[model samples]
Target: MIELAAIATEQRNPRSRHIDQVSTEEMVRIINREDHLAASAVEAIIPDIAKAIDLISGHLHDGGRLFYVGSGTSGRLGVLDAAECPPTYSTGPDLVQGLIAGGESAMFRAREGAEDDESLGKKDLLDKGLTEKDVVVGLSASGRTPYVIGALTFARQRGAATIAIDCSPHSPVGACSDIDLCAMTGPEVITGSTRMKAGTAQKMILNMLSTGTMIRLGKVYGNLMVDVKATNHKLEERARRIVMTASGCSRDEAIRALGQSKGQAKPAIVMLLLHISYEEAQKRLQAADGFISRTLTTASTEKGIR
Candidate 1:
């Protein structure tokens, strides 16, 4: 046996011991109370999470990629985060990726046995052409999934930066990572069902990792997703709104600037704020490394000099 008894996540919760017999409302209250612990657990690890953000952002800025690997719910969360980055930040698909144990099919269906095969983890990274310039984050709530352990091991061997997100302290998965993000969410209400508190903590940490990295990379401007890809009608409207908010322009002016910048909110904001053409806004953005604030600052300094 794998000795799961020692794992904190596998243990039962005292607060929900009689949940089966409790009233539905009481049961919900118990669950909600326990859910609060998840956020507290994540709060305790803010420093570690911030360190991970710095590591990931630095690597990405240097032309590297990020990969999230796991199985089951963990895998699904990774995929969800990676999928949102592109439309939110206007990044290419390959910039951030998610890999599940049984590949894409495992994402929709449970492949419990697939998580036990340690070799499959290594093989999956190999398929992705693992390189030193990449970063791999392994997610496993229990901190003992063989799939995640193998993936982290392979990532380290390949000289890629490795991060581990698990709910158990001093987990096996944590041992394999360069930066261990262990959020001790304790036991679940259902006992051994890590999908509850553990999942929430993982999701919160992931939100920090991806969003913080994007901010550091200049994908954001004044709390706005300036690089948002207006792929849908809603996003097109959002892009216009972002341009207007950043530049204090009328809706019509926002639309005109976006039209000139091909619906890119960042450059449109620059065009409107700096009173420059679309081409000039792009040049300034490139010169300032895609940071709207920096571009505006440089433009102000140059105008003062003139």
Candidate 2:
């Protein structure tokens, strides 16, 4: 079957004629206009996004990780989303993973003709020991990338929950996955240059997926990032500030407790809130399922607080 994305590429739009001749201001306007459509495309798919999120929340509660697979621009977007989860949610490296076609080498230099190989996708999933309990999200702008479709098919065979994110409805990728999130971003400004509009839509949707999943996993408290890891100097500083702000501790007190906890933001927050030593705070957190809010509330009541 001819893929919609490939067919789109074969299309000719008069608006695209002499695109090279457009003035700088007109080019920016046209691009911006096309970009604006991305939001509407995303908005139309919020129900699908929420469905995926609910599934992810349930999977994580049962100790499953989130998995993403893609090729080309879609692959890069998946990788980008997976990379942000750890710092954003204090999750271990295993909690969120992204696999790109052609492996890690494809991240920089495009591996010519690699995305067309379906076996490569199947092998990549098998290499990862993809299990029935995890979630698999395949990203492809055209919704029919052989690689993505193959991965989705393999995921179903393994009993994993499957999802497809693509730009076309009734796509081969959509047919294979359990959940399909099709966002129609229309023709690209540059006429079938999916790296433009479709790519942007996919990136936006993935961002929403990961962010929503993290929030459901309790990574966010109100509007604050409550589970961020203090892994670097700047992050350590931000952790101190967040702890200080959350527990209303003095700078010295927050810094001391943060040091006591070895720069672990959540434990230090508990330490300040409960006025407990770091070790006690650590034990409390472990007992409370690692939620700082719950740990602090329990400790405060145990100590006869309001």
Q: What's each prediction's clash count?
A: 0, 0
Instruction: Give the distance in Å from residue 85's predicted Cα in candidate 1 to where it truly belongs.
Output: 0.7
Per-residue alpha-carbon lDDT of candidate 1 for residues 19-105, written as tens digits (9 for 90 to 100): 999999999999999999999999999999999999999999999999999999999999999999999999999999999999999
Candidate 2 TM-score, true structure as reference? 0.91
Report how far off residue 180 is in candidate 1 (Å): 0.5
Scanning candidate 2 in windows of ten residues, the lowest lDDT window is 3-12
Over the stretch 1-306, how does candidate 2's per-residue lDDT look in tens digits? 784436543344455566678898887877898788888999999998999999987888789878899988889889988998888678889888999998888889887488898888889989989888899999988887888888888999999999999987778888998789998887777776778888999999988888888777766655667688878888878887888788888889888888898878777887777778889987987787676777767876877953
TM-score of each: 0.99, 0.91
What TM-score does structure 1 among the candidates reach?
Answer: 0.99
lDDT (0 to 1) per candidate? 0.94, 0.83
